[model samples]
Each structure stands twice: as structure tokens, then as C-alpha cells.
Target: MIDLAKVDYQVILLPPSGGKINITDLIDAWTHEEMEDQISAKVTLSLKNVKREDGWMHQHVFLDKRLVLEATDGNGWREIFRGSVKAWKTDSENHTVHVVAYDPNYNITISKEHYYFKGGKTAAASIKEIASEQGIPIGVIDGPNKPLTKKLYKNSIANTMMERLKESERKGSGKYIIRSTKGKLSCLKEGNNSVIYELDDWTTESSSDERSIEKLITKVKIYGNSKGDARPKVEAVKTGKTEFGTTQEILYKSDFDNMKAANEAAAEILKEDGKPEINRPLIHPDIPWIRKGDKVRVNSGTINTMCIVKSVSRDMHSKKMMLQLKE
Candidate 1:
């Protein structure tokens, strides 16, 4: 078994000048966290003033320079994060500098452009093309191949990518997740994490069950435009009386031209949002490699079920982490 207390983190700096530097000794603190809904994993580091080849360390650290964090337990090293430095603040008086970075997808989030995707292709195919064009390295890509019929056009690359990902599930395909680490992009089926961990010991503490009622949907109205229709009209309506009464959702899509198509869309939403209860546990010991979308099976006492990690927050210094799980 790996000793958790023996874990040590190292910060490596890759300057634009084309060389690697070990700047771990200059770090004061650092944190790494990511969310399932977000498009990027975030990293923040605080550095102390130190002498370097180019002058004081702050002078050499500039935007877009690569920053990497890695950890080891005397066995080789595993990367925690690797991305370009997006922003920094040099505090001369305090002799310190603060830096923030995101997984290579940062550019995609800010870039806007028009893209044309032909029909008969899956959203996963389009997403792969985008990632490739943007130079994001590809990893495991198992996103569903359900073909897309909806038109996609001008929008922020991030927004457009997110829309396409959502389209997979919106059109009867299963849920999918897109994530990046060390500049490598991965798209896979939700809850299908390749690495599985078993949680059976008392190292975990249970947290309150969360009822995500805000996402609950019992009624749906899909509006679609027809060939002769001057304006879009309700193509179909789906309803199921819940305890909270009518919680409505309105969707306007150009492809929902008939009631049959519209009703299927409505049913899909209801099936996903019908269950509001989403539970999470507070895991004590840190599991550095356990990231969002990773699967874990809990077999401690009364709890025995497989779950997918929903989110993770980790302190680079201590290797401490907290996890949120979705069953």
C-alpha cells in the first residue's frame, strides 16, 4: 500500500525560453480543483520571491508559460496538473507572487468562431475535430456515436462544445463527459471510469443527501418550426404531476418538426430530472488520482453501491482532498 503521508508535491516551471526549471522551493501554497459541469480544471499557486537565472523568479514567470504540479510516494512521479499560466500578480512589497492557470481548454472558453458540421456525424466526432484543431492532445474518447441532426453555428468554442456534448444525451444517447489533464483531452461515457477504487474502510464519513430539486422537471414543452408555420408553435407537451406541482421547462429546437419527435425529447428530460436526490460523501484521506468521473464502489457497513465521483478539491502541499459522489 502506498503511504499517503509520504506524498510530496513538486512544481515545475517551463519557461517560454525553452527549458525546464524546478521551482518547487519557491512555492508557498497551491491548490487544484475541478468540477463536473465546468470546462476546465483550475490551479492556483502562491510563490515567494527567489533568485533565478533571469533575475528574481517573478520577472521570469510570465503569462502562457507552462506550470506543472506532480506528486510522488517514493515510487516515480504522477502529474497532478499541467497548464499554461493564465494570470499572475507580483507583490514586490511582500516579496511574493500569485498565479492562476487552467487546463489547456482555457483558450477554447474564450475563443469564439463559426463552425460548420455536416449532418450524419456524431457530436463526439465534431468535438474530436475541435480538440484536434485547437491542439489539445487526445486520450480516451468513448463518447456516444449517436448522429446529430441539429444545426450548429456561431458561438464560443466552449459553449458550442458543451452544446454538442449535451446534444448526445438530449437525443437519446447516454450521458458523456469531456475533461482534460496535462493538456490531454478525453471524452467518455459518464460513470465509465477505467480505474476503479474500492472504499470499504472507515476512512470515509457520510454527508447529507442532496435533493437537487432545482433540476427536477415534470413538464416539458418543445417548440418547433414547420414548413408553412409563420412562427414556431408547440410541437408537443409532456407532463407528469410531481409533489412540487408543475415544474416546467421550455425548449425551442428547429428539428422537432413533429409531435413524435417532440414527445421523445420531453420524455428524455423527465427521465433524467425525475430523480432529485443526489448524494455525496465526505472522504477523509486524500485520493490524489481520484478525479471527477472516476468510479468508486462503497462497501462500508450499510452502504454498498457503485458511484461516480462528481467533483474534487485538493491542496497541492498536503495532498488532501474532498470528493463529491453521484450514485
Candidate 2:
């Protein structure tokens, strides 16, 4: 078994000048968070009156330099984050420099343009194309192939793309994920993590609360455009109650021209309700490659089910991993 206390972290810096600097010796404390969308890290180092080679402040050269964090045992190393330095600051009295970095995707800005995607491809392909256009690297894709209809990106492609992806997730299609270590994006159809955390050993602890009502929807009404009528009316409704309850969601997608597609959309929207309670657990497991979208089955006294990993935060110095779990 790998020893958690033996795990180590190293920061590799590549400035514009093209040489690498190992900042492990200067770091005092570090923290990094890996999310489904992005990865970020912050390092605090003690550098006294450090100057740059170009006769400028040391912090200036690191403003946009490439930063990479890795975890290593005696055998080899594994990259955890890959991004450019975004901002930095120095403490006047402590002589400590605080540096923050984000994944390469954060640096990409979509150019405003009129864009439309003609159907006939998978959503993963569309997402990959969008990321390529924006200069973001493609990591892993685990999504289903659904005929993408007319998708429009008017002012900001990033905002529109993210919204559409989230909408797809709400429909229980797949998950769109962004990793920082390689600055890559991926779409996952289901949990890909093979690591299992058995809660029976008391190593995995869970804190969850179930809600009384979870956005229950008993009615679905779909409407399509009319030929001659000015305003469109309801075309069809689910064979159930028509009255609104305390918790109800109404889905109206005019783009769906057929009742079959519209009904499917309504069912997808309603699936978001009545899900298992999400929880965050601090797991001290001796494992590697614990990341978002990893699948693990929990067998404990209270809970025994499979869940997908949502977020992972690690402190290399402390040797602890806080994981966010979702059903």
C-alpha cells in the first residue's frame, strides 16, 4: 500500500525565457482544488528580496508563466494541475510571496461571432470543436451521441456553450468536465473511476440530509408553433394531474417540433428531481488518480450505493483528500 505521509508535491515553473525552475524548496504551504469544470492552485513561498533576470520585480516574470503541480513517490510523478500564473502578491513583513494559478482554459476568451451548429454529430464532437476554437486542450470525452439540433452562439460562445452543456447534464445525458493538470476538457457518460472506498472500515465518513420535497413535477405541457395562430397554445400534456403543486417544474421547448421529442425533453427535465442527497466526504484512502467523475461504491452501516466523484481538494503537505460525492 502507498503511504499517504510519503506523498510529495512539486511545482515546475516555465517562464517565457524557456528554463524550468523547481519551486519546491521555497514553498511553505500549498492548496489545490480539482473541480468538474476547472482546476486551480495557490502556493505560498518565502523569497526575500528576489529580483528578476531582466532587472524587474520577481513577481512580474511569473505573471503569465506556465505552472505545473505534480505528485510523486520514489518511483515516478503524476501531474495534478497545469495552468498559467494569474496573479501574485508579496507580504511586506513576512517576505512571503503568494502566487495563484488557473487552468489554461481560464485564459481562453471566445471571440464574439455569429455561430450556428448544424445537426448530425455528437455533443462531444461539438464540445471538442468549441474548445479547439477557443484554444483549450481536449483531455477525455465520455458522452453519448445525440443529434445536436440548431445550437446558436451569438455574443459569447463560452457562456452559451456552458449553458447548453449544463442543460444536457440536467437531462441525464452525460457530464462535461475540465481538468487543470493538462488543461483538457472531457465529457463523461458515467463514472469512470475504478477506485472503491469501503465505508465499513470507518475510513469513509458521510454527512447527508434528505429533503422532504425535491422539485416534484406531476405535469408536463408541451407547445409547438401554430401555422396561422398568432400565439401558440398547449399541444399536449402528460396523462396526469393538471393542477400545480408546491414543487413543480414546467418545461416548454418550442424548438422541439414533434410531441415525442418534447415529451422526452420534459421527462429529462423532471429526472433532475428525486435524486440522492449529495455529500462531501474527507477520505484518507491510499490511492492515486482520485479525480472528479470517478465512480466508487460505498458499503457502510447507513449508506450503501455507488456515487460519482464531483470535486477533489488536496493539500500535499497534509496528505488529505476531501471529495465531493453525488449520486
Name the regions of candidate 1 deviating beyond 4 angstroms: 224-233, 256-261, 279-283, 299-304
What local lDDT score does residue 155 receive in model 1, on the 0 to 100 scale? 90
Candidate 1 global CA lDDT score: 0.77
Taken over the whole model, the C-alpha lDDT of each candidate is 0.77, 0.61
Compute each candidate's TM-score over C-alphas: 0.88, 0.80
Which candidate has the top score in TM-score? 1
Off by over 4 Å in 2: 36-61, 108-114, 167-172, 194-201, 205-218, 226-231, 239-246, 275-277, 283-288, 299-301
Q: Indicate the residue-level lDDT of 231 in model 2.
A: 56
What TM-score does candidate 1 get on C-alpha atoms?
Answer: 0.88
Residue by residue across 270-303, what tens digits does model 2's lDDT show?
5554233346464554344666767766664445
- The candidate 2 region of ten consecutive residues with least summed lDDT is 39-48
